[model samples]
Target chain A: MAILLDGKKTASELNETTRKRILKLKQCGIVPGLAVVIVGEDQASQRYVRNKHKLALKLGMNSVIKEVPASITEAQLLALITELNQDTTIQAILVQDPLPKHINEQRIMQSISSTKDVDGFTAVNVGQLYLNLTGNYPVACTPKGIMTLLEKYDIFLRGKKAVVIGRSAIVGKPMAALLVNAGASVSILHRYTTEIAEYTRDADLIISATGVLRLLGAEAVKPGAVIVDVGQNLDETGHLVGDVDFNAVKDKVAAITPVPGGVGPMTIATLMQQTVDLTEWGLANGK
Target chain B: MAILLDGKKTASELNETTRKRILKLKQCGIVPGLAVVIVGEDQASQRYVRNKHKLALKLGMNSVIKEVPASITEAQLLALITELNQDTTIQAILVQDPLPKHINEQRIMQSISSTKDVDGFTAVNVGQLYLNLTGNYPVACTPKGIMTLLEKYDIFLRGKKAVVIGRSAIVGKPMAALLVNAGASVSILHRYTTEIAEYTRDADLIISATGVLRLLGAEAVKPGAVIVDVGQNLDETGHLVGDVDFNAVKDKVAAITPVPGGVGPMTIATLMQQTVDLTEWGLANGK
Candidate 1:
């Protein structure tokens, strides 16, 4: 059997490191702060926001949740974002996904100040990552977290054949950028891909964020390929699963990140870690 | 022999459309303006700027050339850009590349306002393109022009396998993004790419931007593949050529863009077109 990537354990270690960084900031009378803006009472979004809030407080940092109605006008949302952009205490800002249909989501997302853009959804930050600019900038949490996990396992990325399945702004796009910057020959596949297996079977590393259950199995992937499943889907039995068929491909792959204990945990850990980083970067730049 | 992707003819047709757009703007008492900023007395840079300036004037639009010395500091350059940003008459701005070692090139490039970024090198514009976000925003000229050229040839992008060699900020990266956005599976190969042919041979469409001479010949490419060569290099005879071995592969490929008449002409034409686009967009948005 292949070795489990052990995201849960790695996330805990990362969170531990974040905690120490928070303590250092506290010593300097600087407290890192994160504000999550949720437009509606989405059950999933609510739960995710609550977890981030609780974790921030546990790590001894200030956290704020801005919960508004789904009927909030785009202009009203923009005003709220502008206020947060100028708020000195808020070092990191995230607007919860699945925003109301009435709101211009991209506009609202891009409105966040680049310094406090915790999720790195803004075009400026995304551009920086795409350009491989030489400077400190935030990246999409899930992908950046995956990079950390891969580094922990000593997976060589340079010149490696990698396949990223999906083209999402928050996950797949940024994931490919990170891999490409690492000197990996990265292919980005999406819904229009005629043969996913054609690329995946030759890849040394495969990242799937398609949210399609059982999207990949042993036959679809190369032997000894490292697999990262970013999907959070419900199987036929309603069990939370990833994009890949773990039981089928686990033995064939060299290493794999599991569904629940994989990318999910690392995302939150990286968010917290980045919150502290933004705080330190702000202090260093006298923001 | 393969059909040539005649960029010179296509560019002229595009220039005609741009001229009409300029006429429309002029009828509304608005002169679309472009400013090309050149630092130092680099002959090549000066010539390119002059071509842009001349094109803007030929299309009956206002064109300005800002020539500065090589000794100018980063602060001075930024200040100059700020001046152009506030200049209501200047609709599009381009800063010549290969800037002095002392100046931070990306910083100066990104400093241009997104609306006035004629070259579309600004991170915001790049981000928009990468995100595939809707609405009118400029893109890097060379790749955007290549898209136009491909469209003219009626090349199908959806579900196609595309190999974009190189990952430069202005050409390769944006070209890949455009191809991916159009639903093609894109693999970006760089110098670290192990076996370039492993992907190129399988690609239905190949866009090579790496400035390497005689990179691809008939043997390296697939039969009937649509090839777009963005490299403009010199052969042993000092004749201007492209990344592809045109003479060898021209008879084997379905279509190809000739070096001198290919991507080169379309780039300037696209810049002229986008200047008018930015101008009209500015007028509509009251910028």
Candidate 2:
């Protein structure tokens, strides 16, 4: 059996750490603040927003939820984000994904001031990450979560073979960059890739965020490979599953993360952590 | 026998194209200027300065060679570079490397302005290359040369496996970034890599720049691996050699570059092209 890479336990520890930091900052009359914007009240989006806001309050920070109508234009969305960007009280801004199709997602994403862009989707933030400049902006939550997990596990990335089985901007690209900067040899497989197995099968660590359930079987993974599955797909009975074929490949791997209890909790944990980070920076530096 | 990747033949074509561009700019009374700064009269530095000056003149651009004494402090070298950075007439600046032991190399390298950094050693240029930014800056010459070779042979980098057997700041790191940005799955191997063969043997393309003669043998490279030998080491008889065992691995590889005629000329060619680019951009945008 593979050793479970339990993210829930790790995330709890992180949340506790964040709570303590928030308490300390409060004594100095500083409150970490996060502003979350959601459009049209999509159920999934609402759930995420609720969890984030609830967690922020529990951690002793200020949280604001702004609900917008589905008819909101890109300009309006941009205006709201820009206002939050300049708001003295808000330390971090979160614009939840899945805005109405009429909205120009790209422009709206870019409109968020890079400093308050806790999501790390803006080109400016991407550029900073690309330059290995961690001076500004929070990195994407999931990738940052992965790095945190790696650091917690004492898994050194230097000179190790890392294969990321996706190329999405939010996760894969940033993840690969983080790995490369840490001195790992990174191989990213995307839609255009012909021989994905050739890269993945020999990797020291495999990170799959393709969101395709069971994309990696036993044959696709090398024995003793450390597998990190970022996928979250519903199984036939509506149970959450990951990109890895856990039944087939679990025993062969050295360490593997389970679906619901793995990367999911880490993502939310990083969000809270970055909110606090943005808050602290603002307090100290007054950004 | 493998086909040779001839840099002289390819660079000449590129230079011919650049020469035409220089003439177009000259018609408008705009002269492309390159300043070569040499601190300490090292024989190798003198040769490099002379070659660059000769090439600039041959391409109908203004070239100036500035020599400073060996005992020059880091601050003094930086002062000279700062002056060149502010000189609008000088389109590009090249500071010859391997400076005296007393000077801090990184500090001096970062002092050069990105716009005038024809050698592409400045932090901004490196940041652009690191981030794969949209704007143009002088890329390091060797990577540009390698790109020319790849384009010449119609070898596609997208979705291919590339193994770089070095990690130097000038060649290896930038080379890996270029490959990764172009969609190649790049793995940069260094002295600390435990399983170099496991990575190199599976690569579709392999680039070696360690400057250690015969560092890669038949066992290190698989059959049909396109090898770009950026290494240039002099044999006991003063003949130029490369990292690859050319005699032993030539028959096994699909293509390879000869040491002297392969990457050498391409560096100068790229320098000339960047000088012209700098000139054109300055004339058009007043950079």
Weakest ten-residue segment in model 1 chain B by summed lDDT: B118-127
lDDT of each: 0.93, 0.84
Give the DockQ-based CAPRI class for model 1: high
Per-candidate TM-score against the hidden true structure: 0.95, 0.87
Candidate 2 — which pairs collide?
A: none
DockQ, every prediction: 0.80, 0.27
- Tens-place lDDT per residue, model 1, B1-287, is 99999999999999999999899889989998888889999987888888888888999999999999999999999999999999999999999888999999999998899999987788888888998889999999999999999999999999999999998899989999999999999999999998998999888999998889988878888899999998878899999899999999988899999989999899999999999999989888977
Model 1: CA > 4 A from native:
none
Candidate 2 stretches greater than 4 Å from native: A35-49, A64-85, A93-138, A278-287, B36-46, B64-82, B98-114, B117-138, B282-286
Candidate 2, residues A1-287, lDDT tens digits: the string is: 98888899999999999999999988988887899999996998999899988988988889999999999888888889888988877888888888899987766776777678787776556645655653546789999998998788878788788898776767887897788778887777776677888888888899999888788899999888899999988888998899998999989998888888899889999999998887876666765
C-alpha lDDT of candidate 2 relative to the true structure: 0.84
